[model samples]
Each structure stands twice: as C-alpha cells, then as structure tokens.
Target: MNQDRILLEETFYVLTKKNSVFRVRLTRKGLSLIKESDNQEKKQTIPTRDIIGCKCLRSRKSTTSCSCQSLPRGSLKVVEENSGEQDENDISAYLYIYAYILQNTKSGSCKRERTIITLRFRSFDKYEDNNKEAKRWRNTIKQLIKGEQAQNETPDTPIMHKINEQRKLLVLCNPKSGPGRGKAIFQDKVVPILQEAEIPYDLHITKHANYAREFVRTCNIYQWSGIVL
Candidate 1:
C-alpha cells in the first residue's frame, strides 16, 4: 500500500511580500494557507518525489520577500507584497524555502516546471529562537524528502520488516450481555472509528458460555494480530 505518513505539522502565520498574513498549516503533504475573513483556503501539495531541495535563511533585515514565477495553476500567489508601511506585528526573521517541480497538464500534454515556496513562522519572542526553529524544520523536511527519494530509487530492494501499527483485531462481542447493546455499540460507535483508522477487524458474537474459549482454542491464532474482548 502506498501511504504518505505525516512526519511533522506546524501552524504558522505566513507573511507575503504583499504584506498580507495568512494562517498556514505546514505538513508533510504540503502547506494549507487559510484566510477566514477573505474566505480563502489555498493548498499546496508537494509530493516527496517532487521536492528537489530545501534551505533555511536568516535575515537581520526587517523585510523578507519571496516570489514564484513557474508555480502550477491554482497555486496561490501567497508571497507578493509591494513595499508599504510594515506592520509592527510582522516579525519573521527566518525564512524556509522549498524547491520542487510541479507537473501541469497543458493542451493535453504534461509539462514539468520548477517552483519555489517560502514560509516563515511567527516569532513573538527572540529572533534567534525563531531562526533556530526554522532551521530545524528545514532540516527535518529535507531529510524526509531525501529518504523518500532513496526509497523510490530502490523499489525492488527488500524493505526492512517492521511491526504494523494498525494490526488486525479479533473483536469478541457478547451481544446478549451488558444490556444487550453490544451489537449496537459495535455497529454505532466502534465500527466508524475502526474504519476511520483503517484498522482491519473481525467481529464474532458468542453463541454460548463456552463459545469464546472453544473458538480461541481451535481458531488460527496466526491470522489475528491481537484479540479484543
């Protein structure tokens, strides 16, 4: 199964060169910039395969700006601000730049172009602390991207076996016990959560007093990772 695990997440107030501020969610998938007042929700999904490089920059200067000329269609123009009265609250001394290539379909043909996205988190206190946090995030993301690239390159290689976090569970339900709501409880509450977590499970209702013990004794224990009674 191809799954993109979330390596990290951070909420940052992103400032554009245009002087507009947005609450952005930075994740392994990409950035989600939300502006409630303007009803703007911009999302940038950069696949690990697309990421080419990442870097962190610290500036002693008061102003910081970023631009992207070859961004994909529907990509938000988030980093454009004309020189104007700087807001006192706009305090970002460090910038994290991520470089990647986006594939766009133009006239039924696929085209690839390089794009750059810059983001900075709000720092209420010291500028040095902000720079350090930005650098940490930059390094972490770069390492994850590099690992993804390596995994892709060695697709045929045998992956190291690891314990599954979401393992198959055998749920033993005594439907006739406990107010006779076991079935209802599993159906109404438990099933939805299991489905949400993508957990595989098997439900077995007890038919008699000794049914559970007998089933366990004869059942193929190897098939189930764990039992939940």
Candidate 2:
C-alpha cells in the first residue's frame, strides 16, 4: 500500500457560509479548493495537516444554519419528486470540514486562520439517504486527519500497527524551565491545539538536570513522528 496514494476521491459542490463557491478535492496531501470564475480556475491547496475537524449534519427544514434555501443560484433543489421514492422532508445533508490554514498578515508574516468548507448533499431525496453519504466523507476525512485507517482497511482494523504508530508526537517539557510557568504555558497554549487536532502525544516532564538530553540519547526516537521541546 502506497501511503502517498489518494485513498479516496470525491468531487463536491461546496458552499461556504459567505456564499462562496469552490471546487474541492480530498487527497492525502491536502484539500484543494479551486475557484472558478469568469472561466478561470484559481487554485489554492489547504494542507491536510492544517485540517482540524469535520462533521456531517442533516439540517431540519426549519433551521437557518444550513438550509437548502440558503443555497446560491443554480444550486440543486432540496426536494425533487423521484417517483415518490423519498419518504421524508427531502432535506439536504451537509459535510463541514474545519481547518486552520496559513494566511499572510498585514505585517508580512503568516498566521493560521480558521476556515470551513461546507458541502451540501442532495444526490438523494431522502434526508437519511443524503446524510449517509455525508457521513462517509466525514469518516474518511477524520481518518486522514488522524493518519489512522488506511484506504483499504476496515474501521475495526488495528491500523496504527500497520503504520507502526508513527503518527504520534513526543513532547519533552521542562517543568522547571519557567520556574513553574513552563507547565502552565504548555497546558494553556499547546494542549488545546493538540486536543483540537486529535493528535496523539506522549508527554515527558523532565525531573532532573539533562533529563531531556538523556532521554533523547537512550530512547529510540524513530518511535515518535517528531520530538517537541
């Protein structure tokens, strides 16, 4: 199995909260959003590492959060009578991809800014049917974010072992570095980010002098994807 290979491919008609339209590609490297306007395709690729979380939702006809009524011009109709095959409200299902991509600041430096990609599913008339497809995308995206399940592997497979758990990061913190502020700073600034990204980690607090150095010298560093100091 080639890790670099695209496990699954999907083409989506994505609508943002601001009514922006873009073409989306789900690949191992990143989620590419290419904008087409005036017969031009301006492309921007959001790195897969920047993606944080994703969700699949089925909006009720009454909710304003993401109703089909919010769709822009020439978008799919929410309800179509396909020989009465749909038994419900014929609502649309939505998949939301959350990411923190880098944006250039006015100060000429780059900072991460949160962005969302929303896709509406109306291929099926029934809400349940539409939502099922949304969930398939959500699940696969989550696997990609976590670097967990492989394309051909089942959800129940011990996939981390197949990849040797190389996705996890090892954090070596000095509890005494900031004279009691070190732990506080890491918890306040770093832990939230790690948790939000669903990134697994092994934290080791230095108990004595040269603790981080000794651990690095003796430990098999390859076990960790990266060492965080």
TM-score leader = 2
TM-scores, all models, native as reference = 0.43, 0.55
- TM-score of the candidate numbered 1? 0.43
Q: Which RMSD values do the candidates have, in order?
A: 20.7, 8.8
Residue 192 local lDDT, model 2: 72
Candidate 2 residue lDDT tens string, 147-178:
77755454565565333444689999988777
Most accurate candidate by lDDT? 2
Cα error of candidate 2 at position 58, Å: 2.0
Clashing pairs in 1: 17-81, 18-80, 18-81
